[model samples]
Target: MPVLETPPLVHETVVSDRREPFSDIVIIGLYAPKIAREARPGQFVMAVTPSGERVATALGIYEAAGDRISLMLVVVGPRTRELALLERGDRLVLAGPLGNGFQLQALGKNVALIAGGVGLASLLLPAQRLLADGARVHLYYGARTAGALVDAELFEAAGAGVSLATDDGSRGHHGYVTELLAREGRTHETIAACGPSPMLRAVGTLARTLGVRAQVSLEETFACGVGACWGCVVPLERSSAQAPAFPPVAPGETRDYVHARICKEGPVFWSDELRW
Candidate 1:
């Protein structure tokens, strides 16, 4: 496949901002018009601090609408704390609507979306898009506790059925959310998920068992938001349009695959295409 030109990165001033605390996580909403207009479901942006105090961190472009975008983040480090501290009227230097986002249009009419903890950020936009298209969406969300399963009503408002689970048994199901998906999710034609690797793995496994297509968004700590660093890579079974070219390794087969840069090639991959 031919390489396409990358979109120019832009800096959008934060027209508005706020922090919503849910358990230990924080969801920051930044009003960035360009990003809101360009961003697609499941894509991310590198949010740089105003002072340039540290390297920018990758964050999901959670919600986007006319001139506003939101990011949901877990305040786990100093970098995240910096973003969490921003109040209304502060500025946020954003890099892009980077990486491949979910291909919602191709997911058919019945879809199940699974989210784990902060991973919910990556799927909200997808759910909204799917709902807007008149698709039947079921959101299977899980967190460490009931309080951690934040903003589920947002999905409900978008016309998606919401199901919940938590590790501490403080919510709907008394176990991992994957279990909820496995038991109640067989009806969907596609499964879309974003979360910790283990949860993603389980969702992938379940999708395969049910003979349903799945797209999983991986969670990685990226050293660079761009593909040059090769720090965030995941094994894939086939080359994608976004992957680099490789020489064939055998007569009838192309190279088995290569480690694709998650930051550039994808944070989301077809479950069957991934070697992991």
Candidate 2:
């Protein structure tokens, strides 16, 4: 894949906001022309709540069009709740198009994109990009219930083949979406996923069983959207594209793992390369 240029990071203002019927989720759009133009699929941003009472919250970049960048998030705390209450004219600060996003060019033409719950936030751009490239994209999405499957139609409308799964059987499949993927037994050139850790673990195992490559985005509470905080670190079996090149290990020092910053090094990593 070609190298992606990191856009100049800055704070942009909120230009649009809408509440989903799910009651706890809202979509916020920002007027960040620079970030919108440079951001690739799987990139994210850190936005301060409308109240600015809490630290900036990390959210996936859902859509980027013209000067607008939209984010879909479930309001689960004080920070997101404050963000959810914002209207079209609300002012908010944003920092990003951060982290290494999906390696779309290398993924080939047959791809499967998996999402669970709010994990859907990170997949839309990738699916859209893949479709634009004339790739066959299949979106396997799951939620706790039918209501939680927020934007299946959006993907379908964007030219992706959509498959659904809900834990309660309120949607397509009765169990985990990974099982749905497994049952289909379709071969994909690549599998990209973002969800809870358990869901990712399952997808990783499935990819291995199918002998297909997979990239997964790891979600964590990011204190700082940048790597300086080192709070959202995850262990990797080998150095990654964004991993730190630091002091050489001493003769006796263990080098089996390097702690990579999820906020900077990735929110996305190869499923096979991950140690966790």
The models' CA-based lDDT, in order, is 0.86, 0.87
Best by lDDT: 2
lDDT of 2 by residue, 1-276 (tens): 234564358776766656575878677777778888988999999987766678889999998889888888887888888888888887878888888899998789999999998899899999999999999999999999998889789999999998999999997899999998899785788999999999999999999999998999988999988898999988886565656666666789876778889998899998888888
Q: Model 2: how far is 63 from its true place, Å?
A: 0.7
- Model 2 alpha-carbon miss at residue 52, Å: 2.5
Error of 1 at 112 (Å): 0.3
lDDT score at residue 146, model 1, on the 0-100 scale: 85
* Residue pairs in candidate 2 whose N, alpha carbon or C atoms collide under 3 angstroms: none
lDDT (Cα, tens digit) per residue for candidate 1, span 1-276: 235565568686673767666745877777788889989999999988666888888999889999889899888888988888887888888889899899887788999999999999999999999889999999999999988888999999999999999999998899999998778647899999999999999988999899998999988988778898999998776556555665566688644787888898899888888887
Candidate 1: 10-residue stretch with minimal lDDT: 1-10
Clashing residue pairs in candidate 1 (N, C-alpha, C atoms within 3 angstroms): none
Clashes, model 2: 0
